[model samples]
Target: MQVKDGLTFQEVNAACGVKIVAPDLEKSIAGTTLHLANTKEQIENAETAIREEWRAIYEKMPIMCSVCKEISPRVEFIANCQKGNPCQVQ
Candidate 1:
């Protein structure tokens, strides 16, 4: 098995430069109105719930490019511009 850096709500916004429906999706499911996730499990569960809840709009979900800082698909953003790469758009 491969060791992976666990994904969290903050990581998604800070690292990925994109936003999800909620910071704590599970907490939202549990009647949490604030976008706060206490634990990693909560974060993971919340993310999963977001995915499931938005399954119908999964393809339509907005994915802001961390490279170009635009609300576009990484592939499409890179393809349109003659940049370095998706992760490194120089």
Candidate 2:
């Protein structure tokens, strides 16, 4: 496999035959000691995009009751109406 920058030691171990002992230390001293196998900027951008997408979805629909497993309507749920109907179980 191709070894790039920013890849975790565990990931590199899985991809390659080499086993990493100290992943934390290696990541901390990346570029100086251990070379990364992936781009940190790419990973951060992907994480940001995923977070933004999830935030949008959460804003659209939030407050799912664990007991009833029901999601309340946006307005009623936001208003904290105790009389709100339970959502249909999947």
Candidate 3:
């Protein structure tokens, strides 16, 4: 499958005629020193999206706790909880 970095790990595997495990999108192939693969376009796109998302969150006001009246610093917001940890209330 193609990674966010625009490099097709599948294609690289096909070309090398080797099968490897890549748990994360940006991991090295098993028994290989080279990283999965990446393209300029993919890297740029990834960077742009990251910057945009960061900007959006950074520009927002601090979240105040309703119970404690404590203000929390702006933090990265995740739409998907796939990474396990979501935004903490602390």
Candidate 4:
């Protein structure tokens, strides 16, 4: 769950956790709002909300188009068929 600097890891073992040098790891984890997951559905419910929020954020994010090499908003890219280009290309 630690997302920093494009770094990716599947899982962290408790024994190896002691050897790692992340100063803020403990503080961050401690500060996180914890919810009691009494059932499988509860975990999925929380994760679903979190995923939706991130999806909305990514939708508004702007990026350069690969074909035209021009900046384009993600929403515009998603239009697919609709007109009125925001990037201003004719």
- Using TM-score as the measure, the top candidate is 4
Cα displacement (Å) at residue 49, model 3: 0.4
Off by over 4 Å in 4: 1-38, 66-70, 80-87
Output the worst ten-in-a-row residue range by lDDT, candidate 2. 27-36
Off by over 4 Å in 1: 1-35, 58-90
TM-score of each: 0.25, 0.32, 0.30, 0.40
Tens digit per residue, CA lDDT, model 3, 1-90: 654433334435344544444567363223323332389887777667666665665656476545555565545223212465444446
Worst 10 residues of 3 by lDDT: 28-37
The TM-score, computed over Cα atoms with residue i paired to residue i, of candidate 3 is: 0.30
Candidate 2, residues 1-90, lDDT tens digits: the string is 755544343434343555455546643422222333368886677667666765566566657777676676565565555565344446
lDDT of 4 by residue, 1-90 (tens): 764445345554444443344546564333233333558999898778656766777787887866567776688876842664434444
> After aligning candidate 4 to the native by TM-score, how far in Å is the CA of 67 from where it should be?
6.5
- In candidate 4, the residue pairs with backbone N, CA or C atoms under 3 Å apart (3 or more residues apart, or in different chains) clash, namely none
User: Cα RMSD to native, each candidate?
Assistant: 15.1, 11.0, 13.4, 11.4
* TM-score preference between candidates 2 and 3, better one: 2
- Predictions in order: lDDT: 0.54, 0.55, 0.50, 0.59
- Stretches off by above 4 angstroms in model 2 are 1-37, 62-76, 79-90
Write the number of the candidate with greater TM-score, choosing between 3 and 4: 4
The lDDT of model 1 is 0.54
Worst 10 residues of 1 by lDDT: 27-36
Order by lDDT, highest first: 4, 2, 1, 3
